[model samples]
Target chain A: MYRLKATFIKEFKLLSVDKTGITILFIMPVFLVFIMTLIQQQAYKSMSQSGVPVLLVNRDRDSLGTAVERGFSNFPVAQLTVDHGERYPNEDAIRKEITNGKYTVALYIPANATKILEQNVEEIMGRMFNKGQIANNTKVDIGIIIDPTANKPMVIAITSRLKQYLADVKTGVLFNIMGSKIAGMMHAEIKGGMPQEDIFSYKENYAFRDNRSSYQPDAVQHNIPAWAIFSIFFIVLPLGGGIINERSEGLFIRMRTLPGSYLSLLSGKLLAYFFIALIQFLLVILLGVYVLPLVGLPVLHIGSNIVPLVLLTVVLALAAVGYGLFIGTLFDTPQQSAVFGGISVLIMSALGGIWVPMNIMPEVMQKISSCSPLNWALRGYYELFIKGGGWPAIQTEVIKLSVFFIVCLAISYRIFQHKTNTN
Target chain B: MEGKACIKVRELSKQYKGSSYLAVNKLSFEIYEGEIFGLLGPNGAGKSTFLSMLSGLIKPTSGEAEIFDHKLTTDTELLKRIIGVVPQDIALYPTLSGRDNLLFIGRMYGLSEKELKDTVDKYLNRFGFEKNGSNAVKTYSGGMKRRINLIGGMLHNPKILLLDEPTVGMDVQARTSTMEFLNEVNEQTKMTIIYTSHDMEQANTFCDRVGIIDRGQILKLGTPDGLPASEGCKDLETLFLKLTGRKIRD
Candidate 1:
């Protein structure tokens, strides 16, 4: 055990001294977080500012109507004017202006609009009386046309609301003038009851604003944490290879001759790798919380959600280290371990939902992914971020990860035992 | 073999599981205390396999080796402490400085920090590695690296040191310097040194006694001077060539 401890310390020093190892451990992940934060910030800004650009043309000579149209102003829907002289512009000219993209909407109200309103009111009142409903409500239609260039959803929402408002106004006018009194007289004469009050309330709700033009898009919940977990996973490759390297180099023999056991040596290596992994996790989480929000990206709830994510992730990391050790013992060369080891980790990580979310995957794929420990890890993070979860929600994932650690460690020990007997 | 010595082997043999032949067939040898011994043979003479058995690196198909009055097959941990084997390969980490490698080796031997530091510096300076000790082993020449490999084994100053082809690929200056340094340490410490080499001349010059092993058997064993005198041959090399007939290569 003492000899093994010495081997562990030695191996750690070797890893620290290697320039490539140090960079992989400390520099790469930090740099990646920085770049990701910058991109996310820009995306959020653009999303917030994204708006449709529209133009308006009014050929109507009515001054009151023109003033009503002028009252509505927004950046997405801009009103551009085309003047007509006393003779008035031809309909063909108006169409030509609209077709050339000078205006998004065109309006024209005829000069005899007062006469039309009088005739339509009388005609509509006679039809309402025939149907046994109240009558003589004013009806008006200022001719309006929409450009094809306008967004379909925006046009639909606007047109539908306008029609509904017009219908409501007609009803309101009738009730204010005569319909309410008529109903009251009937109620006094027979039923001895009044009409019930109808409460009407309307408000608009937006989940996320269209602020894209001003800031970058926020990183969706899974991307950063999943990427962070995978970065921790990659640590296993180098650390496992370090053990194989020492064994092949006769360092173990030197160690055995010393005063320690194999267990102590392996523990020391696990300690070093675990701490390095912890540092990596902190750097990524800290950057996600502090640095990501600077350029318009909202920070993830790290203070509240990071603890369970880290606890489970650390357990997974330890399992991965053991898996690496298993491969190291099985393979003769570091290169062999690296190639097979990397591919296996990737496959398991993919199955575990590190590369992709397991929820959207096919049933069979989900089942297969569930077999991987990473699947539970990502799901735990997803719960924290998406499901508003706390410790209780992630307990299952932690337990699953713990099981994986135990199983992989047992297998690793078995392989080590077998190899030690022969080599 | 007749006496129960510090180390003993009887009808010891090993056949690599997948191979068609035996590496060491019914091999046998013995060594006593307070002696500098050499396992001398040409390439492929099973010198390595022989030493490997004593070090307990691999299990014999049907044989046994004991070290320091303990059976190697049973008391592995105790055997490990009693023997230190410097492999034929350069096993030190290339990325680590010489001192760090020594400290690491010292730790494996269960030495404390101060003790390790003292032992590391003592060996580093003794081996003339003062200026280059701080540099990574990768930057050092072949000889310097080999010396470090040798030092790593002896950091705990084990009672026994086994070196396999220690000077196989070094230049003249490095070869002489390393051998002389080892000789001085061996003489002063009175530690048993079991070294294997193809250089009959160096072995003849340095070893207290030598064994000419061929086909996993000790063909001859005597002091460097006595072997030739008994055989009535010219020198150690001539006797070696005569004992093991020359072929182009094995």
Candidate 2:
């Protein structure tokens, strides 16, 4: 026990005095967190400040004998001006506006829209020919021209909405005018039947209240916090590698021979590195909660679930250190141990949902991630913040992470013992 | 004669796994307290393997060793506490200051900070390492780095020091000063020092008793002057050549 204690103390001494080690442990995490937070804040702020812009121009005459514009006049969109009444504007003007890149969609409504609507045949044909540049050999040609330079998503959105409006009007007319005609046709078809049933009328007779509303739940919408949490969580690599360095340096050998057992020595190094990992965690969380908020990524949501998330991260840190110990024992060289240790952590994080959002991953990947410590880490945070889960909600994830911690430590102990035997 | 054997090896043998050759075969020897013992041999002679086993850096495959009547196999901790090891290969941290390396090693032996600091400072000054004490070891000259390495292992005042070629690759002045310093420590503190070296003259002058070993066997064990002179053999070198029947080259 004394030998192990000596080993632990010697490990601490080496860690404390090593300039390279101190910088890696203390400076790297904080620096990376600060840089990551700054970059995320900048991105989030830029996204929030911008909106899609669209323009519409119309020359069609309405039934009131006044020119009707293509879009609503009070529509809350920037650069939504109509073409000049007396001036003839070419397609270049519309292209120029789109080319300026501010407007996402620009619409051009042809003149004499009333002429085409005067006849139902022309109106029906206009649906297929508008924006298509097809020949219409009738009273007059009417069309809505769309700028080719506009974004495809914006164009799709505008066209879909316009089609919906037209479809709605056509449906209203069909239901009102064809209802009685359709009833007569149905009666003729069912002439031999005992009775004819009107499904719509029957549904109307059994009236019921509608109590549904659309509300999009966008909790944890800003990505800055997510980025901060993830970047901070990766500090496990360097911290674990630091312990491995001590082992490779023969500090463990020295300490193990110092009248103490290996357990005490292992415990001391574990506790020292654990405390350091905790400090790293706290620095990142404090920055995420207090400092990141100042840059428009305020604590969007840190519900009661945060406790489990933080605890789970700490557990993962322990697991990472255990992995370091395993690598240290398996490899004799510090460089080799660092390489294997880094790759293992990266694989875990990738599978655990650190690299990609879990919801978008395939079902198989999601299931696989659940077994990863990184996955538990992300879930612990997501539940507390995004899902607003309480302790009970995160208990399962916490338990899994704790199990990972225990398993890792067991593996580490076995490998170290084996190495000592061989030595 | 303190009546205490600093090191006692009996029927010690080591056969590495997967190899038929015995690195150290049935080696047995003893060194009294306050004496310098040299295990001399050529390359592949198993001198290092034997030294490592005695230093508790490794366990022997067969038989065992005793240092100061403490069974090495069972009481390794007690043995390690009194023994300092200066490995043949440089073990100092290349990136750490010389002083920091000494302090780090001193602390491992449970020395108080103030005492370690004073001891390190005194040793560094004596070894001409004080001025460059804060310089990284890798930046120092080979001889300077060797001095730091030696001081690092000895900072805790261990009763027995085990060195594997402590003066190899050093200049004549550096080698001479190092031997002189070892002689001073052996006389002043009565520290039992065992070193492995191929340099016949250095071993002849520095060691009280030299064991000329080859192929895992000790051919001769006696004081430098006690070596059997032969065929116009005038000194330790000629006697060693005639005894081992092999010239020191390589």
Candidate 3:
């Protein structure tokens, strides 16, 4: 028992100074969860989820700005709040409204934006007609400030709509320039600026394919648990490397000579790394519950039946640690452990529907996904999180993860015995 | 060399899996208490294998070895408590300071905190590591790392020390200092040591008895000077060359 404590202390000391390992364990999961949730929120947007509240801060009171105003007024996907800078004085008020979920996006058109766009467009027309016009360089940067918590599809929809309006106006001006030029060459008198034609605007039509009303695209519900599981499994990297180092550096030989069971020495590392894995899960879950709501996303709804959730996380972490130890003991070098362990984890993550939810996958692929431990883990969390389940619903996954943990440790110990502990 | 037998071996043979020859052939020897014994050999002469069996790191295939009548096969727990192993490799953790490494190894052998700290400090001072003891072993030079590795085995001060080329990579000054420190420990504590080395010059003055080994068997067993005198060679090096032949092992 004392020996085990000593080993644990030694491992903890080694880990404390390992800056790279600590960053990989903690920061990587947070980044993954945050980025994946923000980006994939668009996948949840449907026709029923349209008409997002939008604020237009138009300081450019010219032709281009009026075009933007007309575009937003007719925008099919937005509830346009056209303002004359009275209700909201500056960008900060718009940002406050966005954080409070009143508006999903704010369009800021800077002063003189119209003049720059018109000049650049005229230069483009001059270049097209081969008129020896003096070169002019000007740029128009229309700012789009989005709610950080807004889903990706919403931002893409708004930005692309604004871009189409600008392109249409540019084309209209180019055609008017061409008409005036042709009239001048033929020496014909033009009436009312080449008689501008009314161009019909085209709009995008979304096709609604499925009526799966049961599934809601909740960013916090999906990403927090998915990425948490992934980050937990990533514990394999450092743990496997630790095993290889012990074997190759003769630490195992010296350890075998010590008056203690191999399990005790093994426990020291598992306990330390297991703490890291648990902290990772907790951090991610906290971010989901608190941080998600501030950005106008749904807060993660982990029900009051907290025991099952904690139970599943512990078992998942155990499976990850066991897997790490098995990879370390089976391989001879850090390179072998890293390459094989890393590739296997990523493959498991893909098959487990970590990249895409298993429900949308082909039935055949979904069946194969059941073979991945990550899939089992993810399914367990989804049961408690999405289906409002408790111990009875998640028990099977718990048992499966427990079995995986046991088998890995057993095989690792057997390998260790065969390779080094001949006595 | 006159003392009670601390370790006894009889027909100890170890034929590794898928190998044509025994790594440590059927042989018999006794390592007495309070003496330094050297198993001098070339690269593959099974000196390491022999020390491994004595330390209970590996099992003998067809024979028995005992420490004071405690059998290696049936009594490993007791044997592990009685022996210290210094492997050819630097077995200490690289990221840990030398003092921490010693304290951790000492704890593994069931030593108390006070004993561990005091013994670690004494050995660190003795081995010329008074200043570098608090630094990580990774930052140390090769000779310095080897010193820490050697100290790791002796932290608990076991009854027998099994050293496998403990001074292989040390410089002249480091090697001499290490040998002198080890000799001082042996004189003051009466700890029996089984040291293995390929260099005859190293084991000549250090070991009280030298056993020239080749092909997993000991060819000559006597005092270093007596064995060379019997072979009519100038030293253990020439005598080993004459017995094992002039061919290089590796």
Candidate 4:
């Protein structure tokens, strides 16, 4: 225990005195989080106030196609612009416009859309009139052409609104036909052909509600945890470089002559780095929750389940420290460790959805993200913030992170032991 | 001051796993308590390798060594408590103050907080760096770093001190002070000092007994005064050149 304490104190003191290291580990993370949140907040505010640009290509000059275009125009958040096939000439030209980034999303109403709708409506009316049912065989496909590089949330919002509009139109038409048929039957049953006061009444109702308390999808909630985890893992570069420096300077060889095992030495260093990770995590959280809010950014929400948060932080720190130790032990020089550690963190962060949300990524990329420890940590944070999940909700992530920590630490210990013994 | 052997080597050998040549091969020797023993050799003469084996930094391939009746291979923990090793390089943390570095190393040796503070202060004063000890080691001169490195090893007050080229790359004044301080410590504390060096002149004047080594084997071992007479040379350097051949080792 004393040896571990000594090692920890030594490492902590050394790191604390390194101005560049401290800046990279702590200041840089907070700064990045602040910058990202500010930028995203501005972007979201602009999107809400100015609305997203959507191009409507109504090739079919029929009632159904006009209804679809009218639905898009009615949406308050969509800045609808209509291209009546005269400006773009054809479907290929419209697709090229979207691909060229002139518009974020373009909706193409196919030529037979009205014909299909009319057939379906006639079939429903025919069934109500005691006639044989008509088989509506025409397939109407509404082609939603979207720019692949557009902001994901904006594209999804536009697409979903368009789908909702189509569903509403179809349902309203069916309800009108059914209501007319029922009214006619009621009038026949009534003695005076249905009094004016007894006329049928129709209403449409829809609502959306969230049960989770204090739930707001803001940039702070996402960027805070994301950049924090990214920075925590980035400690690998400095920690590994420190170890390599010590080894090259012969301090490690001198340490072997001390009355302690290699495990004790490694434990001490790990303990110090773990605490550093914890401090960094807390500082970033505080910055997001308090500091950013003072500058008009949205406040970050922390869940009530503090235990899960602490556990996840510890496990993640262990994994990071273990990775650093492994790199330090495996590499012979500080330069090698720095290069490999830096590049590895960047790649892992990219794959882990730190730079982009996993849900927005392609299916294959999302699956690949699950293999990154950063992904596991981000998922845990998302559960706490977005899903309002408690301890039980993050058990899977916690277990996976713990397993990663153990595996990395074990491998690091073995390599360090081998290196120390051989030297 | 003759006494029971403080360190005993029994056919100790080390051949790196892939290397064809043995770094230290079938070497055997003993240094009595309170003796200043110098292991003299050229670069790559296995001087550092031999010192490393004694300090328990590396395992011997064929044989073993014992310090104060404790076998180095099996009783490393016990041996560590009694041996202070000063490596050939400046191993102290460059970012830390000299005092802090010493205190840290002292704690690793299990010194209490109070004892560590006092020991660090004492060493700083002894080395005449009390005023500048608080400065980071990176800011110190080469000689100052060497001094702090030596002080770090002996802070625990171990019975055996193993130094590998402790005074390398020092100016004449720095070398003289370091040698004098080492000699004074040996005489006052009756500490067994075993050092390896390439400077034959310092070895001749400072060590009570010297062993001349070459290619992993000790060519001659005796009192510095006696070895030259036996080799029919004017001095220890002449004797070394005569025995090891005048070829420069890379």
Model 1: residue A104 alpha-carbon error in angstroms: 17
lDDT, candidate 2, A1-423, per-residue tens? 433444455456666667776676666755666665566555444433342355555555443113234333433322355554344365566666667774666655556544454445434444544544435545433234455664455456555654544444444434433454445657743233222243454322211122212312132222433444344444445545555655666444444434345566567666666666666666666766777667665454455444666676677567655555556556766677667666766776678766666777899988987787667767666656555566777678778767776876787778777766654
Q: Which stretches of model 2 miss by more than 4 angstroms?
A: A1-49, A53-269, A300-310, A331-347, A413-423, B1-3, B228-232, B243-250
Name the 10 consecutive residues with the lowest summed lDDT in model 3 chain A.
Answer: A205-214
Q: For residues B1-250, could you state the per-residue lDDT of candidate 1 as single tens digits?
A: 1223566777788777667777777877776554668888877777888887777776788877767778877787787777777888887778889888888777766778898898889989988898989999999998888889998888877778899989977889889988898788777886778899988889988887888987777899888888988999988889999988888446
Give the lDDT of residue A70 in candidate 2: 34
Best by TM-score: 4
**Model 1: residues with Cα > 4 Å off, grouped in runs:** A1-5, A51-223, A247-264, A293-296, A304-310, A343-369, A384-388, A417-423, B1-5
Candidates 1 and 4 compared: the better one by lDDT is 4
**Clash number for model 4?**
0
What is candidate 4's CA lDDT for residue A198?
28
Docking band of candidate 4: medium
Higher-ranked by lDDT: 2 or 4: 4
Model 3 fnat value:
0.72
Model 1 Cα lDDT, one tens digit per residue, A1-423: 655566557666876787888787777777766665566555444433543223333333343234334433432333334343233355565566567775555554444443444445445554655554334445355555677775565556444533443344334444433444455656643243323355777865433222223322235455667777677777767876877787887666654444446766677777677777778878887777787667556776643556766676687667666666667767778898888877887898888886655777899998998887667777777666656566788899888877877776788788888777653
Estimate the overall C-alpha local distance difference test score of candidate 1: 0.69
TM-score of each: 0.75, 0.76, 0.75, 0.84
Question: Model 4 over residues A175-286: C-alpha lDDT tens digits?
Answer: 6666666778887432332222525688643221225643557788888888899999988988899878877777877777889876678789888988999998999999
Give the Å shift of residue A258 in candidate 4.
1.3
DockQ, all candidates in order: 0.46, 0.23, 0.40, 0.72
Residue B104's lDDT in candidate 4: 90
